[model samples]
Target: MRSILAVFKREVALYFRSPIAYAIPFALTLFFGLLFNDTVTRNNQNAPADVIMTFIPGLFTFLLFLIAPLLTMRLLAEETREGTLEILMTLPMKEWHFIVGKFLAAWLYYTVLLALTLVYAGILWRIGVPDAGIAFGAYFGAWLYGGAVLAMTLIWSAVTEDQIVAAFLGAATILVLWLADIAAAWFANLSNTGEQNSVVAEVIRELGLRAHYTFTMAQGIIRAEDILYFIFMMIAGLFITTRIVEVRRWRS
Candidate 1:
């Protein structure tokens, strides 16, 4: 446990010390800040909180679509390619310790990036009233969703030595899940307007990444099911990552 935490801290520190980490977060924050300030206006005097809450989660998820894969691409790929894995694997650390530590470290970095976006809330306060509850819940949901995305990216990083392949696979997987709802609809309804046939598609829609997030997060309603879904995904991906590392370690 202690070793895992140590590794986790080291991983985060390493990222912070590098230029890639600094540049990625800074670029994303500025880009998103400009976007939000433009799309979200204070004209109608509607609940600016709801608008911000919904916008931030989707925006962060979009950023993760780009950053998450790149972040985890080097997690295992670079370690093995640079020959650092040989020394690290020979340590007294267990496979679970290594995977969980690295995964947790990546997750912590993700949390920090999301936290830095809190400046948006201050902007909201300056422009209009902020919905504290909605903003908080939405960000919390976004964090969990991003954690799941990062976990899968980490799994892909372990499977291959090529960072490009890792990033493509990670992004592709998210894209597929993101489109699950629409694709499911097309499949469920042959004519695209049927009632009974669409039921099957509607059922599949619940599994879509956007659906769960929109229902729980967009409306400031945090459901246990959505939280559990993200947790389940994180555990499943990490477990598989540990299994893969264990196989490679013993085989070679």
Candidate 2:
């Protein structure tokens, strides 16, 4: 636990010291700020809560498609690229400690990024009443969803030594997940009117990111399965990352 905390602190310090950290958050805040402004301007007649519930959660979900890769691409890839992993492996800690520490660090940073966006929520609150439960659920869902995305990106990072390659592959993997909903629809179209078509469609949609958010968390309908899926993804990513580190340690 101490070793993991040390790694977490080190990572947090590194993020603050780097330009990429500031740049990413600034870009996100700016983009979302503009989005919120546009939403307010366009829907002047709609209730604030309605607009927020309808759009912000979906927008945050889309934002995760980009955020996950950017935040995690360097977690392990940079360590390998710079020859630091070898030196780090010489330390007494186990593989899971390092992997969890780093993953948690990145997840915390993402939470901070999400926190910065709360200004929009504040604005909505001040100007008009918003549903507390819905807003809270949306943010909670976004964080969990982003965690899963980040975990997968971390896996991609572990697979490559180059940060750019890691980022590219991570982004590509996320894009595939994002498009899974479209693929599901396309497959359903190919199938004729039968039980098989619906089954196939249902299966594919279940795998995609949107359906999960749209039907459950974003709607303030938090189910055990929906929450568990993201938790499972995070655990799987960290576990696989530990394995990768073990392999690399052995090879080196």
Clashes of 1: 0
- lDDT tens per residue, model 2, 70-175: 7888889989999999899899998999988888889899889888888888888887787787777788888898888888889988999888888888888877
**What is the per-residue lDDT of model 1 for residues 41-160, given as tens digits with 9 covering 90 to 100?**
643355445676568667788667788998899999988888888689998999889888999889988888988887877777777676777887788889998888898888888999
Off by over 4 Å in 2: 193-197
TM-score of 2: 0.93
Q: Evaluate all candidate structures by whole-model CA lDDT and list the values in order.
A: 0.82, 0.82
- lDDT score at residue 75, model 2, on the 0-100 scale: 86
